[model samples]
Each structure stands twice: as structure tokens, then as C-alpha cells.
Target: MVSLTPVDIEGFTFLAISVELPKTTLLVVTSERGYIMCGALDVGLLNERLKDRKILAGRAVGVKTIDELLEAPLESVTHEALDAGITPGMLGKDALLLML
Candidate 1:
């Protein structure tokens, strides 16, 4: 199953996605400029192999739902995200705010 939802934060709209497969689920919340995702995201690859893309993204581990992903602190973030003031240990929603 796949679910896409619109999340509102401080009057800003962000898109939340949930994909269920086998025993795991993928979760993500995205703003216009960037996104935050569950452990399935590869922050290292984004920072290293895909650095030129300047992808603004963050990853949070151990989150089972989009809401948890939004509330949890990021385990890692892309370099572009760092340059944009998003950082590891920043809450997902906070990172998203900066992304916007």
C-alpha cells in the first residue's frame, strides 16, 4: 500500500508519503525544497556519490510512521542540507522548515 498525505506545519504545507512493503514501511515528508525520510534513505550516498545533485534531505532511524519521522531527530543529513542550516540531531519537521 502507498499513502500520500499533505501535512501542515505552522501554516506551511508539506507532503508525507508512506509505502508498505513486506515487513517494512517507507516513510517520508517533503517540502518544496527538500525532504526527510526514514532509515531507508542513504545519507552517505547523497553526500558522496550524488553530491552534485545538491539534494537537501535528512534521515531518521527507528521510525515506523510518517508522524514519528516528523517528530524524530535526524540521524544524518546531506551536505546541501548542512549548507542550508539543516543538521544531524535536528528534528525532521525543523529540518523541513529550513528546507522550505
Candidate 2:
């Protein structure tokens, strides 16, 4: 199953997406500039192999739902995200605010 919803955070609108698969679910919240995703995201690849693309994103581990993903602290973030002031240990919601 796949779900996509518009999420409001401090008056800003972001897109929340969830994809359910066997034994796992993929979760993500995205704004116009960046996004935060569940453990399925490969921060390393985004930071290194795709550095030229300058993707702004973060990853949170152990989040089973979009709400959890929003509340969870980021475990890793892309280099562009770092440049944009998003960092590991920052809450997913907080990181998103920076992306705006």
C-alpha cells in the first residue's frame, strides 16, 4: 500500500509518504527544498556518490510511521543538508524547518 498526505508544520505544508511492503514500510516527509526519510534512505550515497546533485535530506532510524519519522532525531544527513544547517541528532521536524 502507498499513502501520501499533506502535513502541516508550523503553517508550512509538506508531503508525507508511506509505502508498505513485506515486513517493512518506507516513510518520508518532504518540503519544496528537502526531505527526511526512514532508515531505508542511504545518506552515504546521497552525500558521496551523488554529491554533485546536492540533495538535501536526512535519515532517521527505527521510525515505523510518518509521525514517528517526524518526531525522531535524524541519525544522518546529506552534506547539502549539513550546509543548510540540518544535522544528526536534530529532530526530523526541526530539520525540516531548516529545509524551508
Measured against the true structure, the TM-scores of the candidates, in listed sequence, are 0.98, 0.98
Clashing pairs in 2: none
Shift of residue 12 alpha carbon in model 2, Å: 0.6
lDDT of 2 by residue, 1-100 (tens): 9999999999999999999999999999999999999999999998789999999999999999999999999999999999999989999999999999
User: Which number leads on lDDT?
Assistant: 2
lDDT of 2 at 34: 95
Q: What is the lDDT of residue 72 in candidate 1?
A: 98
Worst 10 residues of 1 by lDDT: 64-73
lDDT string for model 1 (1-100, tens) is 9999999988999999999999999999998899999999999999899999999999999999888998999999999999999989999999999998
lDDT of 1 at 66: 83
Give candidate 1's whole-model lDDT.
0.94
